[model samples]
Target: MASVSVSFPKYMSHIPTRHAGHLAELCIVPRNLSLMKQGSVRELRIVRSSNQTEPLIDCTNKPSDIPLLSCSEATERLKQNREKHKGKQQFLAMYSSIYGGTVTDAAAMAIPMDDHMVHRGHGVFDTAATMNGYLYELEQHFDRIIRSASMAKIVLPFDRETIRRILLQTVSASKCIKGSLRYWISAGPGDFQLSPSGCNQPALYAIVIEDQSLFDSKGIKVVTSSIPIKPPQFATTKSVNYPPNVLSKMEAEEKGAYAAIWLDEDGFVAEGPNMNVAFVTKEKELLMPNFDKILSGCTAKRFLTLAEGLMTAGKLHGIRVDNVSVEEGKRADEMMLIGSGILVRPVVQ
Candidate 1:
C-alpha cells in the first residue's frame, strides 16, 4: 500500500509523521458525513510548515482556543489510542469478573460490573439527559442503578452524590461534546441457583454517549422476531442480563432489518430489542406493548409525556397508548422503538 501523509491543525503540536494512514478514521458528524458523495476521492491536507498554536481541544488563548483539526489528523491520533485493558478490566470484559459499568479503568485493577449475577439475566437500567451540562435525571438513573444492584446484591462503591461527581469527571475526560448520557450497572454475579449473591463490589459505571436516535423524520424498517420475551422479575431494575434482547436483535440482523419486536412468551408484541415498541393506527389510536417485561425507558417516558401534553391542548389527535397486541402493532401503518441509544426509531417491519 502507498503511504498516506497526515498533518495537524495550526494549534496542535507536531505529531510524528508515521501516523498517516490511520488518520483517516475520525468521522465527521452524521449530517456532514452523509452529504459527501460516496466513492469520491477525499483529499488529504498536509501542512508544509509548522507554527506554534493552541491545540484543538486545549487552546486556552482567548483569541481562538478551539482548533479545527482536519479529518486525517484527528483520525491518526485516534488510531494511536490503544484501548487495551491491562488488569481486572480484561477479566470483566471476558465475563470472568463483573461486567456492569459505563467505563472501566482497565489500567486499574478494579471490577466495575457484575457479569455473573443470576438476577442480571432479568434486570434493567436507564440513563437520562443532562441539562446545562448537568444530568437532567441523574438522580433517576442512580435510583435505577441501586435498584438493579439490590436485585442482584451488587455493592456499589459510591453514593448518589459521589457517583454524580464521577460521572462529570468522566465526561470532562471524554471527547463527547454534547448529547445524552449513559449508565451501565449490573447485578453482581452469583451462582446458578437463580439468586443474586456471592458477588461483591459489583461494577457501577456511567458515561455520556451520542444520542443518535432522535426524532429523525426518516422512518425505520423492522423485522419482528418469533422469539418470546421472557418475564424479567427485575424488569424495573437496570441490570446486564441482556441475552434475550441481544438475541432478538440478532434475529433482526439475520433478516437485514434495523431492529426486532420482542413478543411476550404468550406471543404478544412485547417491545423492541432495546426500546419500547409503539404504534399509531389509522383509526387515530396509540398502542404500546405491556411494560411488564420491558426495560423502563426514560426516552419512552418523555415521548409519552409529550403525547399527553399534545392531547390535552388539542394539538394531538390520537389516543395516548398504554398497551397494544402484537397482531395489532403488526397491522399498524407505522411502528417505532424508543430508547436511549436510538431515541425514536420508526420501523416498517
Candidate 2:
C-alpha cells in the first residue's frame, strides 16, 4: 500500500494555452473521447432531461451525481430517446462539470492543467460509472485510483470518504437520465523525471454524461488491432500517459473502426487500449483475460457473476471465465467490450 500526499505540482509553469474553441464540443461530444471498442461512424445526439409528470428534484441542498428532477419529468426523460435519427455512431466521451461554472449546486474552479501531462503525459487517473444514480461499485474504481497513485507514487490529499462523497455527489446531482459517468484525478504537476512525487498541482473531478445513442441498439463494428496493449509495468498504470492509446484509437478511426485492441508480447487477446474484452461463446457464456495485464473491470467481474448466476439458474454448466487464445476469441459467438462507460458493448469483428 502507498501513502498519498496532497499539494501543488512540482513543475506547473505559467505557460498559457489558447482558449479551446471546442470546449463545448470537448465536454458534450465524443468527437475526441478516449479510445473505445468497434463502432460505425455516426453523428452523436444529445438527450436533455424531461421533468414533466413528476418532479425529480430534491429540495435538500446536498449535492448529487444525477440531478433529481420532478418525479414526472424525470420519468419522461428517463423514458427513452424517440427512435428516428440514424447514423453510424463512434465516440463515447461525455464528462460533466463536477463543480463550478454550471450544472451543479457547487461549481468548481478552473484549475490549471499541469505541463507534465501536457508535455510528458506524466499523470494518473481512474474512471467508473453510476448505476441508477449511484456510482455502481465505487470501491473498485477507488482502489484502482489508489493503486494508480501508488504505482506513480502520487499522493492524494483527501481521504477515501472525501473522494467517495465527491464522486457520488457528482453522479447524484446530474440529470443524465440513464447512461455512464467518467472520473479522473491527476498527480497535479511535477518535474520531467519519471518519478511521480514531482506532480505538485493535483486535480480531481467527476463528470456525468450519456453514451453514443446507436450503441444501445445495434452492436459496434471493430477490427483486429495491429497495435498490441502493453503489459502492466508500462501499460497498466492509469497515468495521463494517454497519447499511445489516443494515437492508436486515432489510427483505428482513420480506418473507419472504433479502437486498437492490443495483443500481449505473448500474442494473446490482452484488451482494448481502454476497455476490457469479453468473449462470449455460442453457448451463452463469456471470458476475460486473467493475467491481470488488463485492467480488472467491474462489468468483467459481473460477466463472471452472470455466468455463475446462470449456472445457479441452470442456464449452462459453466463459463470458461479465464483468458484463452486469440483463436478461441475469434471463434467466440459474440465478443463484448466491458467497462464503466460501455456497460456491455457487443463487438462484431
Choose the strongest candidate by TM-score. Answer: 2
Consecutive 10-residue window with the lowest summed lDDT within model 2: 1-10
Candidate 2 lDDT: 0.59
Q: Where does candidate 2 stray beyond 4 Å? A: 1-109, 172-180, 190-201, 210-215, 282-285
Q: What are the C-alpha RMSDs, in order, of all predicted structures?
A: 18.9, 19.4
- Model 1 residue 294 CA deviation (Å) reads 1.6
* TM-scores, each model vs. reference: 0.59, 0.62
lDDT of each residue in 36-86, candidate 1, tens digit only? 225333332333334322223331224544678987675555444425323
- Residue-level lDDT for 268 in candidate 1: 68
Listed per model in order, the count of residue pairs whose N, CA or C atoms clash below 3 Å is: 21, 57
